[model samples]
Target: MTELLKLSGVHTHIGRYHILQGIDLVVPQGQTTMLLGRNGAGKTTTLRTIMGLWQASKGEISLAGMRIESRATPDIARLGVGYVPESMAVFSDLTVKENLVLAARDGPLDDAQLDWIFGFFPALRRFWLSRAGSLSGGQKQMLSIARAIIEPRKLLLIDEPTKGLAPAIVMALIECLKEIKRKGATILLVEQNFFAARELGDNVLVMDNGTIVHRGEMAALAADVPLQERLLGLSLEAHQ
Candidate 1:
């Protein structure tokens, strides 16, 4: 598979505190890769570093074989990366349609793209007239993802789409993501829900202390109870 992004021995510091410690990973073109680990294990930090939100202190970050470690966030984003943070970054005052319109300003919302998104997230179509703040947690998540689709992106770094959401809503979001994957988007998903990650991911990277400790096919990790307990501090069977 062609490598879309590669991080080699990357390190990041926030003020005096070192966050990413020799992080290394590869995101292959057109695949869904999940980053998994316990809290404070640096999954989010890795994604942020890849997006150039924080400059790496050491090593190289390459996007399609081009060095991007020195680039600014906007410049890096312009290179075809989109980020959907865990906070769901929706404009509270704007209506759902308004938020999507803002995201669609750079280019017209292509009929095919709009049709695809609306099909994946029919709920978004229903709430188009509602203020973003008025939507439920799940509905806001739908809006957040829909906005990302408005921008033409080659790589998407998504953070915890299932966090704090109800089970039914989480399932719906997962199906939407599956549809996104089907449409040829490469996704680096940061998620805490082991079951959901196992279901949606093609590949898995386990991080601890800001570095990748293990990586392999998703089913391999899913079947390893001991590994899950050691890294994630939970039993996979229970999550299932």
Candidate 2:
């Protein structure tokens, strides 16, 4: 597989804290790669750094073989990168329709694409005119993800998408992501839900104390309970 996104010796600093320390990873083209770890493991920081939300203190970040470590956030987004932040940063004052419209950076929302999005997240359709702040937490999460896929992107950086969602909605999100993967969208997902990770991830990277501790095939980690416990502190079976 071709490498869509690559990071070599990447490091990030927020004030006096050194968050990411000599990180190295690769996200292959047309595959879902899961970043899993305990809280404060620098998973979110990795996603943010890739999107240029936080500038890398050292090393390099390349997208589609182009150097992008020094690019601005908007420039990175314009380079076919879509980011779904863990905070569910929707336009609180705007209606659902307005939020989606803003997310369609290229131009007006495509009716066909909107229909497809609605199929996965029916709540967005129901509250098309409702204020984003008025929606529930899970609904906001759905909207956040929907905004990222509102238009086709080369790579998607999603952070803990199923954190506050219901089981049924979680399954729906899994299927939605599966369809995206089928359409050849490369995804770098940070998820705590091991079941969703096992279902959607082709490869997995485990982080610890701001560094990658393990990297391998998701199936291999899932089948090995001891390895899962050692790296993630819990087995996939136990988490599920």
Candidate 3:
């Protein structure tokens, strides 16, 4: 598969804290790659840097063979990258349909795009006239992801999607993401949930203390209890 997004020797800092140290990652076209780690392992920072919310202090971020490291957030987003942050940052005052309109303006919204999101997230369609703040955590997450797909994107960066959601809701989100992958949107996901990561990821990169400690196929990592224990410092069975 052709590379859609590449981060080479990337370094980022927030204030006096040096969070990402020589980070490197590749998101191949038509595949879902997971960034796995314990909390505070820089997974969220990596996603933020790729979105240009945090500018890289060193190295390059290439999207479809073009350098985008110095580009502003909106510029980078316009270049076909959509980011769904952990907070599910929906406008509290706006109704769901109104928020969708804003997202449509940011990118082009055709009938097919609206249909696709509504098909994947039926709850979003049901609450189309509801205010964003009135929605549940899972509903907000669905809205956040739906807005990202308002335009056809070359890549999608999702950060901690399963956090603070009920299991049934998380499963629904995972299934929706799987459907998105089947439709050919390359994804780079930052997730701490082992079961969700193992389920959705084709490949996984385990980070510790701002550095990649292990990288391998998801199936292999899922089968290897010792590897999961050593890298994430937790047992997958315990998550069940």
Q: What CA root-mean-square deviation does each model show from the true structure?
A: 1.6, 0.9, 1.6
TM-score of 2: 0.98
Which segments of model 1 are wrong by more than 4 Å?
A: 237-240
| Top model number, TM-score | 2
| lDDT by residue (tens digit), candidate 1, 50-143 | 8888889999999999999999988987888888989898998999888888877576667777777887678888887889999988788888
Clashes of each: 0, 0, 0
Model 1 CA lDDT for position 209: 87
Look at candidate 3 and give me any clashing residue pairs: none
Sequence-dependent TM-score of model 3: 0.94
Candidate 3 C-alpha lDDT tens digits along 1-240: 688988899999899999999888778899999988888999999999989999999999999999999999999888888899999989988988888888875544577778877876788889989999999988999899888877778899999888888898788888988988898999999877777988899988888888788887888988999988988788766654
lDDT-based ranking = 2, 3, 1
Q: Which stretches of candidate 3 lie over 4 Å from their true place?
A: 106-108
Count of backbone collisions within predicted model 2: 0
Q: Which ten residues in a row have the lowest lDDT in candidate 1?
A: 231-240
Candidate 2: residue 154 Cα off by (Å): 0.4
Alpha-carbon runs more than 4 Å astray in model 2: 238-240
